[model samples]
Target chain A: MDKTQQSHLLIEDLSVARGERILLGGISLRLSSGQIAEVTGPNGVGKSTLLRAIAGFFPVRSGRMSWVESEAADSAPLAERLHYIGHLDGLKSALTARENLEIGLRFLGRDRRTPLQALDRMELAHVLDLPVGYLSAGQRRRVALARLLIVDRPLWLLDEPLTALDRHACALLKAIVAGHLGSGGLTLAATHEPLGLPGTIQVRLGTR
Target chain B: MTRILLVIFVRDLMLARRIGGGGILGLVFFLSLVTVVPFAIGPDLRLLSRIGPAILWIAALLASLLGLDRLFQADQEDGSLDQMFLSPAPLELIVLVKCMAHWFVTGLPLVMLSPLFGLMLDLDGPALRSVAATLLVGTPTFTLLGAIGAALTVTLRRGGLLLSILVVPLAVPVLIFGVSAAQSATISFLTPFLVLCALGLASIALAPIAAAAALRTAGE
Candidate 1:
């Protein structure tokens, strides 16, 4: 992955609401270059909601979410600058894994690796030509994660990235995230299990 | 920028060619609708020819709406819609490209085959040609209009029926102009035809914007 130097993410006193109710509130966090924030919380604690909120999928009632790239703030919109891996795997079942990743690479407008190389990194190159529907649940999840490798984005918002992954794939994900962070990329993952990477920031929400 | 839009367009066309996603359903449904009309009118060649333009317009309108119901919903269900939101390409352009591919598969074929459907309904040479020509300019309006309905009802289960209900009423003007233009093959061919073209252009400009707005809210 290409190095993303001097990128930073800061969320201050963020409050996200749904309809008439506030799902979570009073949250604050900062992530500079080469760091990972593991958002851990009990179920229904708005873990996924926070990730979605940052990705601009969920509504934020109050907060100043800003990004600074290369010593200059007010860079690209966070939606275009970040990657969000939600629960749905985000792959079209009719298309092969290679096609899905290629579309992602083009649409994301940033390229780090070819679909072949990205899948191989997750030990999933053999399934490259297979339709995503044919892949098992774990394989599909790994293919979805390969999307992260194809794009060179500064921030990653992952919701339960470890789900359905076997031990090997889980380790693969951790190494991928670690490599990403080492390259000066920032990541925020909502996970039940530990990412087990060093210096992982724990942002627990919904305490109130 | 063109490359990104082309990628989305190609992916959608590929899906629509696949088994369950194929546009053959729309074509076949169109053929069936045309086929049943002759029988319903009891072999009255004069009546069939007289009403052939209306039948073709209505059938094409319904057929084009077939593939649109899943235009955004399938992407939403698979999580690709979120990735789309994150893309540098504008969402309205994305919606337009997807709808273009959709119309290519579902709408274009119907336009090409409508002359044959017209022949089956005892239409004359001029009527057949005019029907095909008008559909080329008109079917896209159905796809564009249906896109709004599709995006509005995307998160709802069984939105296909609701999509029809919502879009059909709105498609009346296009239908009226389309049928009139086709039926006017022997008369002033330019008037209603131009109006139909204007409707197509207007929908092409505006539907994507409206559909994209609806999709933005549906993301939550």
Candidate 2:
């Protein structure tokens, strides 16, 4: 597979289960470059499970999920081309905000902007030196949001990216998602509230 | 790949330092265990020397298990383990890095302080040296085995007791060979030491893959 080719995700009749309980089934979707898909549903409706399955965190009981090149049969592994942000922000409380972002960028193994630049974009420059344990819930969310900007991946799998944010932070997150879409990237976000992004295809999961 | 592993290693070490009582706490626990033995058994120098190697080994083993519960707990709780699972680097490599960091933080201190405890137990020079040698070679195996237990119980809220139960049985071989190697250092030292080395090598090669599989299945 050519490394430069863009990724096109295809999910065909995917089903997921948690122990004896089946969460969601018969789900199918296609996301090409520069597309955004919002997975919306009520609580306990398998919204997070669908995103996790795409991120390879959950096993798909039936059907296939693949990331194929635009013109070739060869496909890239989803893990290499995607970023996943779940309910818990992956931050170490002992480290400063800048330190956490730097570690995240380094772990992603991508050539990208400096951690300070990402934090600055998130309007967290004033608290860059503060340990993440001392930050407010909203500030911590922004720091985690900055992680999405520090690396350049083709796909993003975000679960509830707007849980603890104020109205302004929500607007900031929407703008960040918009910018990611503008740059020919793909986003699959699961949220209870509307993502408020234009042209976003909604995947509403019904409760089991 | 090396850079990413280094970042994780350094981050884990920093957490061990900054978080509540990591390396120092392990050392203090080791010291208290060493100090309490004399009181329990009554102050007898011959008895102390006779049992010093076993006592020191037991203390080191228990100290090594002190921090094992937190091996993956913090990462699992903070959701970093999920991100790590999705990284371009393999999960086995990440698990290996974590185990190495854990050993460095918790196990190395006990090995370094075993000689002091050995002296306090009235061990002679040769006995002290041999106890330290066996501990240095054997503690990593204990740590690697404990990591499998840690990963298996990562999802449980109170996994410390279960971790001890699961890991102690697996660590019996290390304990046996560790004590034997120290006891027979004056005689045929090569055989027991070689067996201990083999156990350590096997744990190094196999534990990470097993632990990584456990971590994956845990999320499922």
Candidate 3:
């Protein structure tokens, strides 16, 4: 392992377990800025669990994980550089789409203009003020992804980011992933099928 | 940090006001409880005077607990709780802001309304004033102490009942001093009022840290 290389995330022999059940065993991976990595695996093979471990959602059973930025091991808290979008959209049902985006940006220590642009990019300008509960499933997925545009973090851990999205939304997401990679922002996305992402490395964990 | 706390507090307080019907319902419940007591105990003016303060304080505590149950429910569901944990704001400051906001809406209003309820209970002017004064100072302590229980039981599905079970025990001292302060107006009034104030100050200082730690452990 090249410990001195500038990697955004370094996971060494990381093992995850739920009680006695081993979800991932002796997994090692490194993520560097300006790259995109996709985790593809069968159901219950711990793609989501691996992402969670990298984001520090839980402690690794017998190994270690470290996050770095600019060749320096970043010791800032989770919010400073990591943006995690889990299975749920994390939107408020009662609030309008715009309000949800604004609140999310505030929580991430950013402003509103970028989120609005992201919503516009997703063709959601018309429904900006509509309560998210009224939006279609694909629209809700876009709203969740718009979070990626609002904050300028260098690392993204997306779990099923394309779930419930349509063909157009999927294409848009592909372009967004490309842009993230071009900006030197590392992304680790979990998906079941081909995302058409440019030069993405696949890590198939089950029995690999 | 204060801004973040204010945002959390204001957002939840406004939502509770608009959606949960906490403001109106809490007052109505307190009113009914106070109004029904005279009928149950019979209109013995002396007995009403003797027990009125205790009854009012108890009703207010119980009524406020209704809204307190929902304090963290929305945040827990919407991933906001996790985000708050990730925030730089000390968990204790966040918990304190939430408890203060709860008091402002639920307990503070009850303080202002106590005098009106006292009048219905045939309380004298000085005793009614005493009740208002004591509640004004004591309700924050009640809220802060109750918040510890709220934070502890937030993860439980049927938490309101459990919150009462946990909180009612800790709130005993506040209830004692609050009612006593109101009742003692007929004698001297100064001693219990000062004691209530002291209890409020102590709770203001201590309860936030306790509630924050309890909430983090419960969430874990």
| Position A140, candidate 1: lDDT | 98
CA-lDDT, candidates in order: 0.89, 0.88, 0.78
Where model 1 places Cα greater than 4 Å from the true spot, the runs are: A1-4, A71-74
Whose TM-score is higher: candidate 1's or candidate 3's?
A: 1
Kindly list the per-residue Cα lDDT of model 2 for residues A1-208, writing each as its tens digit. Answer: 1344566789999999878788899999999777899998888888888988888888779998888766566354778788898888999989999889888988887757788888888888999999999999999989998988898887999899998999988988889888888777899999888888888888878755
Residue A203 error for model 3, in Å? 4.2
In the range B1-220, model 1's lDDT, one tens digit per residue, is 8999999998887787774544788899999999998888896789889998999888888788877778888888888899899988899999999889888988888988898888898889988999999999998888998999999999987998999899999899999898899998999888999999999999999999999999988866
TM-score of chain A of each: 0.95, 0.93, 0.90
Instruction: Give the share of true interchain contacts found in each model.
Output: 0.86, 0.78, 0.11
TM for every model, in the order presented, reads 0.96, 0.97, 0.87
Score residue A63 of candidate 3 by CA lDDT: 88
Scored by lDDT, model 3 comes in at 0.78
Residue A87, candidate 3: Cα error in Å is 2.7
RMSD of 1: 1.6
State each candidate's clash count.
0, 0, 0
Q: Label model 2 with its docking quality class.
A: high
What does candidate 3's lDDT look like per residue over A1-208, in tens digits? 1233344777799998766877788887788877788898898888988877776555567887777766465467544567777776777777778877776776666453666697998778888888888999889889988887876677888888888988888888889888777767788888886777767878878783
